[model samples]
Target chain A: MKKWKRSARLVDMTQQLLREPHRLIPLSDFAERYQAAKSSISEDLAIVHEVFQQEGSGFVETVSGAAGGVRYIPRAGWERSRETALRLCRELENPSRILPGGYLFLSDLLGDVSLVREIGLIWASFFHDREVDAVVTVETKGIPLAYATASYLGVPVVIIRRDSRITEGSVVTINTVSGSSKRLGSLSLSRRSLQEGARVLVIDDFMKAGGTVRGMIDLMSEFRAEVVGVGVMAETLTEERLVEESASLATVTDIDVKQNRIAVQLGSLFR
Target chain B: MKKWKRSARLVDMTQQLLREPHRLIPLSDFAERYQAAKSSISEDLAIVHEVFQQEGSGFVETVSGAAGGVRYIPRAGWERSRETALRLCRELENPSRILPGGYLFLSDLLGDVSLVREIGLIWASFFHDREVDAVVTVETKGIPLAYATASYLGVPVVIIRRDSRITEGSVVTINTVSGSSKRLGSLSLSRRSLQEGARVLVIDDFMKAGGTVRGMIDLMSEFRAEVVGVGVMAETLTEERLVEESASLATVTDIDVKQNRIAVQLGSLFR
Candidate 1:
């Protein structure tokens, strides 16, 4: 292997660390890859860590021991998180998002990959130290957010399906009722999707009375998985809240279909 | 702002470039952020570009002019792509994945975030130059893959629902028949999800007779969106094929339910 310059090593190291957040890379691996001394690699890591800390992007955590390695822990700074939450509130406040039956058209916002990633970063930052084994969510709208958060946290995503499909093989199905509309629904998870006793972080695009989230928590019990934390991109203000504790980035305070108006505010995360 | 050291600047620049792939950043922006001269930034970018090119990860593309800037275009090396495809084939060949009805259980593999990201990188490398405006996929299993590919391409994801929901507002629905099973289904896309005449790349987790992909392409027509490309994580071998051109990472050539065996091979992407 050719010797790598310090500048080239720094760029490559930063790229690798950012690419696989929460993954540990041994110092020997870097030393071998760059054909450089361990001392040199340490110096390079310090520079990278300093830059990340200053930018509030994330930090490189070092584990000193035979089985220890360095891992990147991604974080959204308080200012950045607040900015994202405010931006989400503004986006949710658009009158054009108002739909029939008081439902907001959120596909556009959910479809925005950049925004989804930003929100995922915020959730990951909040739950980074929770030792989350997997990020879970119900299928369709929440899959992107779940995947994004899982990516940042270096965990797999276990999706609960609305209807059990043949492709999922054997699944555990549970009946659910919407808290706001009282609509009956079924949530299913593949038997093989999650391991028993694994810690999971729940993520969703929206929460109305927290019915779906509550159902997810109930289903997680079947797998013997622990719900380390729960997060939603946005939650509506409702009189009936099924889930007792959860975090949200934005709140829909009021939506009047007749008046074509919607009121939005920062979620509990900011508060 | 404090003046950034060259090493710190390089690390920060690499992180920003990797975080926002395909987003062009003006040299002046970096100059202002780092309190450094454009000449220094240019020198740093050259080093970043060289490392990326040599590693086959990607290159920093420079658009020289008043309106032109630099952007990171991520690319998976051919060797890496082949390795990922082969690994996927091996994973698919597990006998335990064989379901009673010959449907292979893939939820576990699809739930793996790192593997999904690797596959996404390969797809992005293949379609990065096609100028994909949005990634489109039918709801359920494909949502994660669509989001992953869209994230790599720096584009939004437009999900095509199996059944139009009230939350989608007004949707364009198209009836489709499963080319293999001869089952009828409806594919719906939100009218607001995509723009007229937008270039789209279709992504899915699996393709069997290509019915879903075909339906997605037809639905794109209603939005006047051009189907720039189509990709699937896996495809099944069948006598009847509906789609003419598509890429897959792995192909299940045969499935024996009685014997609980599955024969998997590299998809067209490797060939």
Candidate 2:
């Protein structure tokens, strides 16, 4: 292998770290890849680390000891997260997003890779210290967010399904009702998806009365797992709250379907 | 904006490009962000681009017109993709993964963030140049792959659910058959999910008889969309292939439930 210059090394290291976020890479690995001294690799990492912090990109932590190495933790400052959240709110406040029912048209938002990714990084910034073993979400809308968060956390995503299939082996299913609508629904998870006593961070695209969130929490209990945190992209400002301990990036305080008008606010992440 | 050095600028630029793949970025934006000359930004981009290609990460497109800048397109070389596919097959070949009905347990692979992201990149590399408007997939198991590919393509993902809901307004549903089992199923897509005449790329986790992929192809036609391409993570080796215009990463040529053995080969991607 040819010795890599600092510029090329910086770019390559950044790609590798970003590709596998939250993974520890020993300095020796970089030294071997670049055919450079450990000291030089360390200097390159410092430059990358400083720029990452200044840009509110993420965190780079160095671990000492025989099994020690450096890892990239996806992070965004509270201020930057709040700004992203507010911008998300503004983008969603358009009247055209108001559907026939009280629900908002957010598939586009959930489909926005950049927005979903930023939300993931911001949520990761808040929960990186929680020691989460996995990120969880129900099937459908929440899958993308869960995957994004898991990518940043370097963990797997356990999806709760509406219906259990034979391909996943035996599953644990729970019946619950929507906290606001009283609509009965069931969520299922494969038995092998998470280990017992695993600390899980629950995520979703939207929370209304937090019924689905509550269902996932209830389902996790069946596996003897601990819920470390709950993150949602948007939560409605409803008085009837089923899940209390949760965070959201944006909130819809008012949605007038009759008039095709909607109001959005950045969630408690800003506060 | 602060004037960033080549080292710091390279790190930041790589992050920005990787954050949103397949989206064209204007060079002026980078110049403004770093408060540096366009020439300097180009130099930084060249380093980033070279590293990306050398690392088999993705494509760094430089558009020359005034509206042109540079963008990243996630790509994996055939050798790397085949290796990934073979690894995926080995992971699935476990005897314990054999379900009661001979269906392979694959949710674990789908849940794996690194694996799923790599498969997404591999598939994106094949379909990115097709000018796809969006990546489409059926509900349930296919959502993750759809989202991953959509992320790399910088396009939205359109999920076709088994049942229609009021939340997404009016939807178009179609009844289809499982090409292998001959079971009837219905899939629905939101009217707003895709625009007319969209060139869509369809993706899925597994294709037994390509029934679900066929359903998505039918659904796309409802929107007057063209099926630009189809990609599956794995396809069963069968004498009869319902969908011919498709690509797969891996193939299961044999499965022995009685003896608890299975065989998986790198799909035709190598050929």
Measured by DockQ, the strongest candidate is 1
The sequence of per-residue lDDT tens digits that candidate 1 reaches over residues B114-222 is 8898888899999988999999988888888888888888898999999999999998999999997889999998888988999999999999998888998999889
Q: What is each candidate's DockQ, to 2 decimals?
A: 0.88, 0.80
- Clash pairs (backbone) in predicted model 2: none
Predicted candidate 2 versus true structure: per-residue lDDT over A1-271, tens digit per residue: 9989999999998888888987999888999989999999889889989988988888688999888889897788777888889889998898987776577778778777778888888777889899999999998889888988898899998988888888878899999898988989898888988899999999998898999999999999999999999999988888889998999888888998777778888786665
Q: lDDT (0-100) at residue A256 of candidate 1?
A: 85
Q: Per-residue error at A80 for model 1, in Å?
A: 1.0
Chain A superposition TM-score per model? 0.98, 0.97
CAPRI-style class, candidate 2: medium
The number of the candidate with the highest lDDT is: 1
Give one digit per residue, the lDDT tens place, for model 2 in B41-123: 88888888888888888768898998898999788877788778888988977888888889988888899999998888887
